[model samples]
Target: IHSDRGSHYRWPGWLDRINGSGLIRSMSRKGCSSDNAACEGFFGRVKNEMYYGRNWAGTSLEDFMCFLDRYIRWYNEKRIKISLGAMSPVKYREHLGVTT
Candidate 1:
């Protein structure tokens, strides 16, 4: 998993968990945001498209969670990404013969 060099990520407990899971840890280089640009871009798009101009003052936690879940599904299954041949992530995976 790629993450910033946060203190929580560097804790012994977190390190143990990651090691036990066999997941490689990738940290961005010091003072460099380019290494995590893709992740940043995704957050920016999500906020701009789904979060901006929204009022969540009275929304329950469950309702917000549901909205986030639906948006994520739509992003993966319906939204086309220009970098992926104008195909949604689900379609791109299918095109690559990846069965999920």
Candidate 2:
């Protein structure tokens, strides 16, 4: 998992969980904004498209997870990007004859 060198990530509980899950921790160098820009941009788009201005109060955690999963699927498979000539990521990949 990629993250900044934050104190929270260094906490014993967090380290234990990462070790238990067998996830490799990849921390960016200090003051390296470029290392996180892509993920930050993606997260910004996700918040703007599905999270902002939504009344998520009273929603169950399971329901929230389901909604997020569905939205991500749609974003990858249905939402078109002008930069990709108005094709979704999945369609663009297919057009390029790329297989996942």
Candidate 3:
């Protein structure tokens, strides 16, 4: 997990969660927002596009997890980006003859 040095991110509960989950915490250097700009932008898009204003009152954790996973796959493989000539990253790479 990558984050800026915000107070909440440094909180005991947050730290415990990350440590308990065995996920390595990566923090950006001091005063360098651009270091994680692309990641931040992707997270912002995810939150806005899928999470904002949505009610998950009766959704089970497993179902929500599945939804999130599918959404990310779709975002990376199907959703087109205007900056990539209106192609998804996968398609743009293929167009450039970059095999993956």
Candidate 4:
């Protein structure tokens, strides 16, 4: 997993958990949001295409939560990702037969 050096991400025990998992840990260089541009872009698209467009304009928090849940499910299950060769995240993972 990659993260900026924010305090939440840079907690002392964070490295221990990552190292314990045998997966490599990586960080973006300070002040370089471009290093994490893919994630930033994904969130930008989510907000622009779904979230911000209807943000908090509903009847109640329950309704808003329902909208967010549905949007997230659709985003993961149907929205095509440019980086994933236009496949949804779920489709990409299932094609690879990954358990996680």
1 or 3, greater by lDDT: 3
Candidate 3 Cα errors over 4 Å, as ranges: 8-23
Candidate 4's residue-wise lDDT over 1-100, tens digit each? 8777767576769878877888676778888888899898877887898767454754697887787789878987888889998888888998889937
Per-residue lDDT tens digits for candidate 1, residues 1-100, read 8888888778899899999999999888999999889889888988999889899899999999999889988987889889999998888999999957
Alpha-carbon RMSD of each model: 3.9, 1.3, 2.3, 6.4
All candidates: TM-score: 0.65, 0.90, 0.77, 0.51
**Which digits, one per residue and each the tens of the lDDT, describe model 3 over residues 1-96?**
887988878899999999999999888899899999998999999999998889989999999999999999999888989999999989999999
Q: Ranking under lDDT, best-scoring first?
A: 3, 2, 1, 4
Span of 10 residues, lowest total lDDT, candidate 3: 1-10
lDDT of 3: 0.92
Top candidate by TM-score: 2
Of candidate 2, the 10-residue stretch with the lowest lDDT total is 1-10
Query: Candidate 2 has what TM-score?
Result: 0.90
Write the number of the candidate with greater lDDT, choosing between 1 and 4.
1
- Backbone clash numbers for all candidates listed: 0, 0, 0, 0
Better of 1 and 2 by lDDT: 2
The segments of candidate 1 whose C-alpha lies over 4 angstroms from its true place after superposition are 1-27
Per-residue lDDT value at 44 in model 4: 86
- Stretches off by above 4 angstroms in model 2 are none
Candidate 4 collision pairs: none
